[model samples]
Target chain A: MSIEARFRIDRDDFTLDVDLTIPERGVTALFGPSGCGKTTLLRAIAGLEASQNGYLKVGDEIWQDEQKNLLPHQRPIGYVFQEPSLFAHLNVQRNLEYGLKRLRGVTPKVSLKHAVELLGIGHLLERKPHQLSGGEQQRVAIARALAVSPAMLLMDEPLAALDMIRKHEILPYLESLHRELDIPVLYVSHSREEVARLGDNLVLLEAGRVQAMGTVSELFSRLDLALAHGPETETVIKAVVAGYDEEFELSYLDFSGGRFAVAGKRLPLGSAARLQILARDISLTLEHQTKTSILNIFPATVDEMTYEGTAQITVKIKIGSVAVLVRITRKSASELGLQLGQAVYAQVKSVALLS
Target chain B: MFTEYDLAALWITLKLAVITTLILLLIGTPLAWWLARSRWRYKFLFEAVVALPLVLPPTVLGFYLLIALGPHGPIGGLMETLGGSPLAFTFTGLVIGSVFYSMPFVVQPLQGAFTAIGERPLEVAATLGASPIDRFFSVAVPLARPGFLTATVLGFAHTLGEFGVVLMIGGNIPGVTQVLSIAIYDHVEALEYTQAHWISGSLLLLSFLLLMSVYALNRRFSVVKP
Candidate 1:
């Protein structure tokens, strides 16, 4: 089961035309720059925007088409806006119940208690919306949406309105929601860090068009995509915790690429974790160095290379079945005689454990 | 110091204001909501009609209304065909007149309040499974409470001060069509200065209190976030 959507929306200044088939589970991020039709697509799917010749089907349910157009309230969806728009008249508990009370004949998939616990908003149930801080209000808003137990969750930059501190405050609850819920999520964001940390599938949009669509790793490291040539270019690795070195306080994560040693014992053995590797953090060598301070050294095959500006070059290398990127000066590329399909050693200097 | 005629006029004035306010709210809410949210290009024409009483002289409006509610007019002719008397000189006629006379007072504040709410809250409510009517009562109305209060007070107070419209249509029948303002006008015309002063002073005090309470409650409401 998947979500199939085709939308063409024309405004005075811009047009959004796209056809997409998104997976039914996990977080699929609509990643793009501002005014790139990311929010428009999400709203069209939620039946909030009227698009010309639109077609939308979530799993087996047909929400919109030539003959059928469901209203926003009629569709089984929970949408979290960029602003935490809680009702001023209702307290947190009543706001949460607002949706639940309107769920005509359909059994709620997420109970109010479960939603409150998930967002950690149990203490705020009695307080009105104005009494809560911005972050707390957003959490209550999230809980209020969850209490409806929608078939799919649509989030349009749920953290974009918050400051850095408040964003950090809410990210963990979002992560837990991703982990614990079975509902598919369409997360719209322009932040690369947010996409890397929370997204499983990526739909890259540019100028109201789909630039690329694939897994987060595939789209980030693809040489043909603009994401590979930027300063913030990075790749995400899904790995399992193989073991924990208690004495050294390091956790070994195993992926298709290789085993990564991260300085943390927080993740239990066999649990899944995500690792973020930056292109600037890796260097290419002609031979394996046994006398290096770096703990991770893997034999990689150079698959592709692209020049970055005038002085730097970005190279895509494959370690086992996984892909990684290395940035080197243009001068170093020629001196070392790098070529496609050439086997080399990739030395990593840093890796960020995303989750 | 108040006579039986003065008391009767006071009672009639209060009754007229209360009924007019209640009737205005019942009809004004949907009209204001539509005016605030509709995308029709011709909506301004309707808005201008609703606001006509604000700029037009009260006697002019009353002249047209008196024709409309009289025996020869379409509304009164239809009523007569349905085995009813013409509404020209009845309490119902004053109510209809006041509803028209004070429409802008009730609707403009409501339309402004509804517009200030923006689309986010209603969209949020709809996505959360609220139907159209449900969203109106649950979200829009509560959020626009200050507007409602202002509309109510202004509608009531403006109706209490009606004189020209009632004189044109109601004919100032004491203890029936005569209200406080009409009774004061009669006192002044008859050279009863003391009775006119009493009624005028009471009206000034009542209007002041009504307006003051609206401001106080609206301040309290504004303190709460939308």
Candidate 2:
């Protein structure tokens, strides 16, 4: 199942015309700069905007088509907008129950108790929205959306208004919600850090057009894509838990052609996880070095090179079958004669465990 | 402490106030919502028309109403064609005059309530799977509770105080059309100062309580900042 969306809407000051498709599995983030119609697309899909055109299909159901138009309330979709948008009159529990009660049925896909537990809002049930902290309010908002047992979930920058501390507070809940729930989620954000943290699939948008759409690793490491270059550019690796290294109090994570050792973790074995290696944290060597303090090393092949700045250049390399990006000085790159297809080794100073 | 005439006046007052408020709410809600949200270039013109009764002298309106309900006028002619009474000097005519006279009291509060909502809550409700009517009852009505309270009380109280319009159209018939305001006037005209004091003092107290509750409750609710 996939979401097929095609839209062409004209506004007084701006017009959004684009067509895109999203796979029906994990979090597909509509990532873009602000004012690029990312939020408009989300609203259109939710049936909130009537001036929109084209077909919008989620799985087997067509929310909007030339022949049929489903009203927002008629469609089973959970939307968490940028604002927490908790009903001010209702307490946290009643706010959540508002959607749950509307979704009347015998076979409920999401249970009230389970949603409360998942979002950790069980204790905030009786409190009004204004009484809750920003993070707590957003959590309850998500729980309220989830309680509807919608066929799909659309989150439009749910944490955009929060400060860093509040963002950190809500992110883990979002990550865990993604992991625990099986519904298709389409998230929208322009923050690369947020995309790196929560995105399973990425759809880069700019000026009301799609820039790219692929898995996080696929977009992050591809050679031709501009996303793999410049500041905050990083490599996303899908790793599986191998075993625990008790002596060093670290977990051994195994990927395609290398083993990554990180700070100790308590995850169950064989569970999948992600690793993000910043481009600035990686160094390249022509051959294996013995005196290096860096422990994580993998055989790398230069895939493509692009001059990012006068002093620094971005190098895309293959670690077995996966791609890793390394930014090196122009002088160092020239000394090694780094060209496409040249074999080398990547030395990483550190790697971060992304959920 | 009430005479049988005073009781009839009270019943007339209640009937006028209740019917006036009920009719105003039904006619004013959608108009207020539209006034709150419309983008028409001349929308202010519509607002001025709705508020004309607020500043228009009650006698001035009653004078026009008197002519309009007379058998020779267009409205009375239409009623005659439809096999209905001309409606002047009747309780129904009193209600019509009161509805027009008390319209601003009901519409202004309801409009203020809808405008204060600022569209976000309704948009959120729409996204949360609430139809327009569902959201109106489940969200907008509850959110606008204080405003509704104020509007209803003001409409009722304003109708009870109506004198000029009822005098012109209702003709002050004691049992048929004499409301409390007219009854008070009649008592004072007969040199019954004590009975006048009783009736007038009751109306004054009732109006004062209605306005006091509006201010106090609205103040409290405003500070609560829902």
Candidate 3:
């Protein structure tokens, strides 16, 4: 099942027109800059912004059609705004219970106990919203949304109001939420780091339009998309921890492509983790070299190549089913004679271990 | 040393203020909510109408209310046709006049509070499964508590101090239309300076306390707002 949405909204200064079929199972990051209607689209999906010309369907349920519009409260959705919009009058426990109490019909899919535990907010139940820290309040906000057991979740930059430390603090809970829940999450964020870390499906929006929509890795590797050109350009790989080399302080990650080793922290064996490999760190090789200090070396076939300005070229390389982006200089590209269907070795790079 | 006549007048004045404040809250809340949320181009017209009592002379308001509630007037004529007495110069007529005179005091603060709440909280409530009415009571009302305190106190105190409106519409009748302000006037007109001083002094002290409490509570509430 998927979420089918077609909306056209006109305002005094901007117009948002988008048609999308977002996957219903994983986190779909609405990645964009400010004024891109990311939050507007999220609000529209939750039935908060009433669109005159709109059609929305989540799975088999028709939330909005030509003749009828379900109100925001009528739709089974959980929305987390940028700030922790908790009920100021309520203590943390009551705030969490607010949506759960209003739930109608269907047995609650998410239990209150589970929500409280998932967010790690058991100790804060008695305190008022103002009494808690900003991060703690936002955690309660997330738990409150989950307590409703909604079929879909819409988060409009849930971490935007926090400091760097707080964002880091709350991100693991959000990652766990994405991994633990079966609900589809439409997460709107402008932060590439957030989208890369948590998003499975990415919908890049630019100025009220859908610039590109694909898997996070696929979109990140595309040379045509501006997302691939900047410092944020990085290939995301889903890898399971194969084992640990205790002597060398290295952890072996097993993906479809092959085995890769990284400086080990404390990740349990066989647990899955995400890795972000930047394009600049990757070097193209005509032959695999054994006497190199670089630990990550993978042989792959070039799928496509695009020139970047004058000096460098971005090559999309396919290793098994996973795609990796390598930025090489023009002299290197010409010397290696890199072309479509050419077999090449992508040598060594550090990977950002994101779980 | 307040006599039975003075005590009765005080009781009637309290009754009028309390009833008027209650009725104004019921009427003003929705009207203030609308004024806070509505984007209609003509909303300022309704705002101006609500504020008419603020700027208009109390006697001028009394004049229009007298015409409207008189026997030959539309409201009084309607009551007469329905086999009830005209509302003119009755206790109920005094209440109606007080509600109109004190309306701005109740509505303006409520509107300010609701506007201060902005749309985020209500929108958050809606997404959290609260219906519009539910959001109003469960979220909006509690959030606007300071405004309610201010409005209630202001409405009650302003009605207590009313003079010209009650004089124009509610004729001086002991234990009925004769409120504290009107009774104080009666005492002064008869050269009873001592009785006037007692009533006037009590009113001055009471109004001061109510306004002081409202200010203090509003500041405390604002500081505690989440």
Among these predictions, the greatest TM-score belongs to 1
On a 0 to 100 scale, what is the lDDT of residue A171 in model 1? Answer: 95
Candidate 3 chain A minimal-lDDT segment of 10 residues: A225-234
Error of 1 at B133 (Å): 0.9
Per-model i-RMS = 1.1, 1.5, 0.8
Candidate 3 displacement at residue A45 in angstroms:
0.8
Candidate 2 residue-wise lDDT, B1-226, digit = tens: 6679889989999999999999999998888888998888999998998899888889999989878887877887789889998978888889999999999999999999988887778877876778889898888888887789889999999998999888998898888898889888888899888998999999999999989998899887776554
Best by lDDT: 1
User: Per the 3 Å backbone cut-off, how many clashing residue pairs does candidate 1 have?
Assistant: 0
Residue A62 Cα positional deviation in candidate 2, in Å, after optimal superposition:
2.1
Sorted on lDDT, best first, the list reads 1, 3, 2
Cα lDDT of candidate 1 equals 0.93
Model 1 per-residue lDDT tens digits across residues B27-64:
99999999999999999999999999999999999899
Candidate 3 residue lDDT tens string, A1-355: 9999999889999889999999998999999999999999998998888787799999998989988899999999999999998888889999998998898776899999999999999999999999999999999999999999999988999999999999999999999998788999999999989998999999999999999999998888888889888654789998999989988988889999998898847588888788888888899888999998999899899999888778988889998878898888898999989889999898857888888
- Which tens-of-lDDT digit does each residue in A108-178 have in candidate 1? 98989999999999999899999998999999999888889999999999999999999999999998899
Against the native complex, each candidate's DockQ, computed on alpha carbons, is: 0.81, 0.62, 0.86
Q: Estimate each model's TM-score.
A: 0.98, 0.95, 0.97
